[model samples]
Target chain A: MRISVDSDRCVGAGQCVLSAPEVFDQDAEGLVTALTFAPDPGERDAVRQAVELCPSHAITVHDHGQGHSQGRDHDHGQGREDGRGHDGVVVDDG
Target chain B: MTGAQPRVVDFPLRRPGEPFPPPRYDDYRRHPGLVLSYLPNGNRVWLVTRHEDVRAVLTNKKISSNPDHTGFPNISDTMGVPRQEQIPGWFVGLDSPEHDRFRKALIPEFTVRRVREMRPAIERIVEERIDALLAGGRTADLVADFALPVPSLVISTLLGVPPADREFFESRTRTLVAIRASTDRQRDTATKELLRYINRLVAIKEKWPGNDLISRLLATGTLSAQEMSGVLMLLLIAGHETTANNIALGVVTLLLNPAWVGDGRVVEETLRYHSVADLVSLRVAVEDVEVSGQLIRAGEGIIPLVAAANHDAEVFTCPHAFDPARTERHHVAFGYGVHQCLGQNLVRVEMEIAYRRLFERIPGLELAVPVEELPFKHDGVLCGLHELPVRW
Candidate 1:
């Protein structure tokens, strides 16, 4: 799995690092720093959870098998049916 | 539906000096997203009690944070001060691109990295306050001696306010935040004085820039004098006020629940249990929207009872009990969505250091007066103790 972070949109909520510390860490300012763009198979699930829980939707994940990337643009103005967002992004409010 | 009018619960259901009332928790559990009429003004509003519903209302774009909208729920008469008449730069009341624009400019200054870099200084401030508290005999008013000053000094250091002016800003901010304690005239006077002081500081910064937030903002040349003053006032007041209360309240909570005194989870649980700014996050519906199966019409107001939502039994098991072991960190104590608090990371660091050091240094600390005898700040926008007299 490949991962990237949009530093411009990050508010440093620290959800990413909390969820997937192996793949993501925070700089001194609390902004997300991608420690590993390519994660081992064992770390994929945690990475996915981090991407979904990011409050700013700053984390993006491209699953090799899925052949598509998931990020902010993919989710439009619809609220998340599950009632959870990338960190607390509140998917429905977009 | 019956012909009888639906029960109208007061907007701010919690009373001063009380944990969120048990009945309110029951109300939230039973009616997660019920529309109830707010008292006094009688504005129709959705009382979002469930955590999920509260998140939905907070994050909904259709729900505007702009308090200028008609029919917006006003929890207190003091809060009803006209928007235009009130001091500007309170971005909490703005919506959309306007809120985003200002928030964007300020985000970099509060990033985790920046807060982490300041941790050493914050630790030093916390240590110094403890030192002062110890030197002042065996008894002290925790609020004045330690709780209030630690964050006050930290914020002053960050803003680059000269040490000589620290006492002035601190006193003004105390009056400004204590809406119930201070008369409206006093509030107005304090605000005007603070704004004038910031403006003078800004002019000085223009002539001789320094390595501080004010100088940095002036150097950008983005905000006008009034705008800059407004931002500084908001930061100055907000910087110390909430965290100060948290520190005091957190100590009281830890003393009551000694097992959780030094636990890191104590901070999260304290924030969740108290939810200090209980009724302030009022949003007006700018467009028709449905949340938690309720259709809220446009122009209606919504008040997310954060303390109630935090105690919702469905999300938190045994919600009423203070269980620091529970690891659910999704509490909306600092708010959520686009307007989630900008200084939350800093608050976490401050609280963690404050609690750890206080307990480690003064393990025998105990309240001098009974908790019931302590004065609780009821009239203010935030809920906290007026003074916590304590001894070791």
Candidate 2:
């Protein structure tokens, strides 16, 4: 599994770190950082939960093994990202 | 159903029982979309219930938190106005870019690391209050004696407010957090006094800079003296009131269900179960926004009921119960999106230490009065006990 975080979208609420501290940590300013981009399979549930729970919809994950790579946040879209498929992997610049 | 006068409901939905968020909300959650509701000011607002819809409303950038917005619900006259957007450092009610400017300058001071550094002090302070509580006798008002002081002193220590003036601010803030319990004049008086006091502190900090939030922010020169005062007012008031209320609520709720105490998740569960500050997350549609299949037109107020979202049965089973063992811990008690509670990490550490230490150190700690006799702050934006008589 591969993980990525959008620092710009991050509001530093710290949910990511709290939920998946092993895989995520916040900087001095509180924006999240992935401690290890590729978290162990054991940490996948935590990572997935963190992605789902982030208040800003800031974190995203790409699970290569199961083609799993989406968050409940983006799935709803809320008209922010046009044509963004829920099942499709979301890759953005930053 | 066509002409049913839009189903008017109280915006904050005045507290109903042992723990609040108004049970009327449970029915609102089952409805298809945002239910039309009326505020204390008799203004219209779309009540956003359900975990999914609340999160959507929070994350939607088009929605504005600025209280001055035309569509913003008029809640200020009752629950202390959110200080206008023109107020330089009143970022609580400002939108992004502007809000980001202030938050960026302040986030470092409140990050997990900075808050963690204060752990020893928090622990010491909690212990000291408990010591004082014990000294005062087995029975006393835990709200004032223990819960209030721990966060009040901690925030004072952080903002560089001198101990001499702590009482002045604490009293004013107590009036500030009340819902309908306090008259508009009382809240206004408190707000003015706090701002005036903070402005004076800014002048003092300028001449004698110290190692604290006010001194540090002023030294950065990012915000002016007046602006810094605005920020400090927010920090000082928000920093203590909500956390203090949570501390008291956490204590009382745990006393009601002692088995929930000692467990680490009690803090989170308390925050969720008794969603104090539920009504503070008010916003308006700056542009038309869709939530829960309904089109919320521009210039309409929105209340993303934090308490309702926390208690959404879809997310939390048997939502009303205080179950720390619940799997989904993602409650919106601190709100969501860009304006998420800046002091949350600090609040968490304070609560964690307060609960853990209070239960551990005070062996026989339990309520002095029965649960029904307790004074709950049902009429305010922040839900908390007015006083918790307890005996240890």
Candidate 3:
């Protein structure tokens, strides 16, 4: 598994560091820095959870073994990508 | 459902120094995302207890933060009145493009990197306050001597307010946030005084720029004088008040559970357990939305009962127990989504350093008075001790 973080989109909430400290560490400003590019098999679940829990959706993980990348990339104006796939779920009550 | 009398829960469900969630909060959690009636104005608001539901409503774009919106649940009669009467610069009460614009502009100043750069200064501020406490004999009021000064000075430095003016700002802020403690007249006077003070500060920054937040905003030229004043006012009030209360309350919690001292887990759990700004995440449903199987209609207010959600038994095992080792990171103490507390990272840094250093220096620290006799700030918007008397 390969992991990458978008610093531009990162707000430094520190969720990634809390979730997978071994694979991810934060700089002085709290942005994510990968400690190990290829994390051990045992750390994959945590890394995946970190990616899912990032409030800004700033983490991207490419699982080479599965040949798929799981993450979303969008502008700040776009709402959060919770991975629920319900982009337009909210509607006007009127 | 028209004429049905709702079950009324008092707006602030906990008293000062009380264990959070009151005892009956668990009963409310059983229904998950049910709407409960808030007695303050008889407004029916969706009380989201489960973690998932709280996160959903906070992140939902259709739920508006504007207090002017119809059905917005006002927690107190005096509260929200100032905003309703005039234009509000505090982005906490705004939504979308406007909220994002203000937040984005100020984000750089609070980023982890930026806050890290401010660490040395923050550390010095902490040390000075600690020094004062130690010099004033064995017994001291932690709230006034240590907790309050550290953040107050740090924010003062950030705003470039002269050291001479710190007392002026601090006294006014104390009045502004204490809702039930102060009358509406007192709160309003403080609000005006703060605005005038900020306006004068902005004028000073304009002529002689400095390395402070106000000067940086002035350099950008994106905001007008009024807009800049509003933003500074928000930062000044929020920056010190919440962190000061947390520091005081955190010390009390640690003293009670000394085994958790020096544990980072204690900080997160303390925030979750107390959820100081308990009812802050109130939003008005601008449009109909379905969240966790409940269909919330338009014009209805939604109060994500953060204290209750943090204590929900399903997400947190033994939710009421103050176990510092619990690793739940999804608590809504600082809120969630676009409106999440911008100063969270800064607060965490301040708190971690404050707690660790405090315990290390005052190894024999203990409450000066019995817990039952200590005064808690029940009349204020933030939940914390009014005075934490301690001895070493």
Candidate 4:
């Protein structure tokens, strides 16, 4: 599984870094960025916690077989039932 | 949705001779510690109305602001909303760790140095509004003309949004905070629109980084897209709305009590007496804690009534009266303890400039309408007059 951050929703609260320092780091302005991580089953819970703990509710994860667009598109306002997503950006799922 | 006893309640009963139904500080002092009150829903809450008790409750880490604990009322509980769903969650709602992180990150922008740098610009905005009010000629509404615009402009500038968006943000904020949005659809639509607007702005800032706070936020790698959006929403609500009400109500308080303006210490007293934010953002019981003699269990909600606390007779002499020299800094106007407002010093500077410039420039600014008829959104989170009509 791989973790991803929807930059649009990140508020840089730094909770993610506190929860999983191996996965995240905060920039000067307090926005969150993902760090290098070798995906492992043991880390799913950590990633999930980061996702849930985000005050901005801005993190998501996708498994290797699952297409990034398929698994996490529901978030970031993308792939909704109404089909409009993050800042109205339409995802092109082929 | 659960009908548990409200962790806290407002009895609506006030002592005799008080302007509002709730009793003044003196009444609470006669019966100190915690005052039990009831909400219409029948939730029993412990209201700490005295300065000592309010301070005790606020500083105690045992008092958690988080809502996950069943006994703790949601921060939005005052409005009676449940935790699973909330209107663009505010940072103030989070307990330590998350709360500390968000607040600390935003601290730089709200610092005295940073806020003071905006003073010239703030003064300019204040002057322009005052000028327009004068040009409009007699009977201008202070709320719209002076109070609202000052903080709205400051916050907009901080976010790099056009000042023109003030009307939209203001109306949206009113709907979110007002009691009239009885239907879920209405509330949802407002929340959705606000989220949509902030989302779009966040997107734009990502592409073209402006010098505003949003751009600074975009550059930070610490937050995810969703978190960034949440922060924007939080800033929109806390950064401007609260200050606007403070400015409006504070002005009204001074106008209603003319003697206040002349007092050598009107600034401090005005902040204490007519503090615009009636309640500090609610905090949850992090753990079982005791204030004075009462024990509040972990997860229970404790609302420190700053207005009531400011007037708590035990803390101050003649707590009900608007005395200019109360000789106390116990006022919870900006709240107390670890989360006391980061923007407070800036608020003081803004208020000082606002009052000083108004009196100095207008010379004899006074209310044009009777205090009773003045428009006040009675049920708003930040209680203040809708339109403070005033004339020179």
Candidate 5:
């Protein structure tokens, strides 16, 4: 599974980083921007919370291996995305 | 369908003496006992105006403040909203047990001792804001200059709300509090924006542990996500809006009566006379109880008019005028009884320091605009000056 953050909603309050330090890091402006692991199998729980705990409902976690059944969509605000449909393959964006 | 209605009409819902006049409600003083007809929605309700009656009703649990009851009227209808807009959600609407429990959880954080420990930090925040105000020039809008920043800095620091998010909260609060929003659409829009902002902050606090109130709550797991949002919403509204209004109006009161600035008696007098808290917390009557010979049925809403109570002649000799030396220990500014404001101590210390430093730092401080020209949050449940322009 992989995670992507929507920059518009992030307030840079550093909450995402606190939930999952291994997965997210804050930029100079204090906005959470990127990931530490390409395919961090060990940090799945932290990544799940990092998305759930975002106040703005800006982060999305995508899962690839188990088809549509692999990851339950955590109904945050991210609806459908045009990016890669599967998880495991990491999409790196700053 | 219902039993015979009580003699609600005979209660004489109007004040008795001369009106309070401009800058003060003209009709508030004259007919202290007069119950004015006020409708928050389509439901007809009576507003109790006299000090004694308001206090009696506010402290009485028999008057239900909750919106779910048939007797309780919806105040959010003015904004044309379907569901009632729970402005200060959580305990603001609760009665007795639920109110007591939720408030108890956070009471320790706001105690005199806890707040006193924050004095040095609060003082520093005040000094910095003052520096910024003076830096901009000798003259400034007292609302923006002093009133706005004092509580903003204090609350943000205490809660560990990030510094960058401060501007967002400030802007959203200003928009939401102004009762003068021309249309219901505008008011609703502002409300949604503020709620969204708060929800975002809540999400952040959950993940990131800090020394703020939000972080503390997240760590303990005492409150659910919904409950936490409700409480934070209360803090955002109560913590800053009330304090900001008090500071603005307090400055106006002191500047108009300069003697009150330094005189301990006068400051006390100003607090009573020009109370920033125009209305008292809403109390819902849980059961039918008779007060002052009137049997107000169960579930009816009772609002304690703090302004009216402070001026009750039965309670004080000359109630209307601002007299700092009055030795009366009982004032309803922070309210009376068990559910009084938890942040009262913080508000008091902040106001005292703000006023003391304001006048001392700028000796010639005086209003730049006429009192008549100044704006106020007149129609709001909690009323005070909107902008206080001053020059030294």
Candidate 6:
């Protein structure tokens, strides 16, 4: 899974770092910083929970789903819910 | 959705000490959509109760939290006209731009990193308070000796109340909360003195800065001195009891659920479960908006009940029960969107330290009064304990 954080959108509540410290860290200003661009599969659940818990929706995830378009689409407002499953970016076979 | 008129219930049905958001909160959520409710003064409002709907109402820019708005739900007549006139920097009662200005100036001070750095200091405060609490006696009111002071001192530290002035700050805050008996005149004096002290603190931070909240806020230069004072006052006063009550209720909650006492999930669950400021998120819709298949027209009062939403059965299984092991659900307890509680990280850390330390140090601690007789503050903006009597 891929992860990203928007410093501009961050409210500094720190839910992301609190929920998934292995993958995310806050910058000196307290905005979120992605410690790793891609996290181990074991860390996916924690990252997903961080995205869900983020008050500002500052975190986004993209699963390596079916040959899909890949663009750094952080715009268009609340880009986290970009068609991937709300729980995670996993695509369904059905 | 056919032929269902918005159901009516008394808005803010006050069932104090009954665990706020009472069972009736379910009545609104159980309905397919928002309900029409009336405030005590007969003002009609749209009460958003479902978890998703509450999140929507808070996040939507069309909603206004400003008290001066045409449709804003004024809880009391006293809060009506004079609110816009008097209070300047209380951002909790403000909307964007005006609210954003204060939030922008103060956000850096409350970042997760800043609060993380504060953990050790917070732990020290908790330890000192616990040491004092234990030394006082085996039997004492936990609220008076423990719950209240821990947060009060921590907040003072955050606000740059130096150790020398800590006693003065505590006494004034205690007076403000009526934890100590004082006449209205005395309470008024306490308010003036605290404000005066805050002004002095701001001046000191301006001249000789330190690594504290007030100093950092002055460094921002984004807020005027008046606005700076307003924001600090809001943080000191508004930020105090919410955590204190959380600690008080968290103590009672943990005592009842001893096995789950020290778990980290317990903190998040406690926040969601009690949702102390149940109806604090009141708003007015600025533009037409649709929520859960219902349309909220502009200039209409609205209340997105956080307590009710936190307990929504759809999001949280067995909604009313406090189960740390229950799959944690993201709750709107600190609220959602631009106006989400800025001090959430601080509150989280304080509770974590307060609960873990208190229980670890005093393993034999238990409630002094029966559950039925405990004093719960049911009839206020904050639903918390009036006093938490306990024994070691």
- Docking quality level of the chain pair in candidate 6: acceptable
* Predicted candidate 1 versus true structure: per-residue lDDT over B108-204, tens digit per residue: 6776667788999899988988998898999998987888788778887788878899889777777765555678799889888987888888898
Between prediction 2 and prediction 3, which has the larger TM-score?
A: 2
Tens digit of lDDT per residue, candidate 1, span A1-94?
A: 6666887667666667667878888674446789887778788778776765565668776554454345464232354333234444323210
| Collision pairs in model 6 | B16-B378
TM-score of each: 0.86, 0.89, 0.84, 0.70, 0.69, 0.90
Each prediction's DockQ against the real complex: 0.23, 0.45, 0.18, 0.02, 0.01, 0.40
The per-candidate TM-score of the B chain, in the order shown, comes to 0.92, 0.91, 0.91, 0.84, 0.83, 0.94
In the range B1-392, model 3's lDDT, one tens digit per residue, is 33343444555455655655676677766753465665467676777777767777777778888888999877766334344333556777888777766776676677656778889988988887788878899999887788877777788777889989988877777676555457889988998998898899999999999988899888877787878887887787777778888888899989999889989877788888888877777788888876666767788888887887889877888988988888666678888776778888788778888998899889999999998988876655567777889999
Query: Per-residue lDDT of B16-70 in model 6, one digit per residue for the tens?
Result: 4565668888877888888987766666789888887887777777788887878
Tell me, by TM-score, which candidate is best. Answer: 6
Clashing pairs in 2: B179-B380
Number of backbone-clashing residue pairs for each candidate, in the order shown:
17, 1, 3, 44, 27, 1
Candidate 3 is graded, for docking, as incorrect
Global CA lDDT of candidate 4, please?
A: 0.62
DockQ-better candidate, 2 vs 4: 2
- Candidate 5, position B164, lDDT: 86
Which parts of model 2 are misplaced by more than 4 Å? A65-94, B1-12, B15-19, B40-42, B77-86, B163-193
**lDDT: worst 10-residue window of model 5 chain A:** A69-78
lDDT tens digits by residue: candidate 4, B337-386: 54666566566767878887787788778878877777666555555666
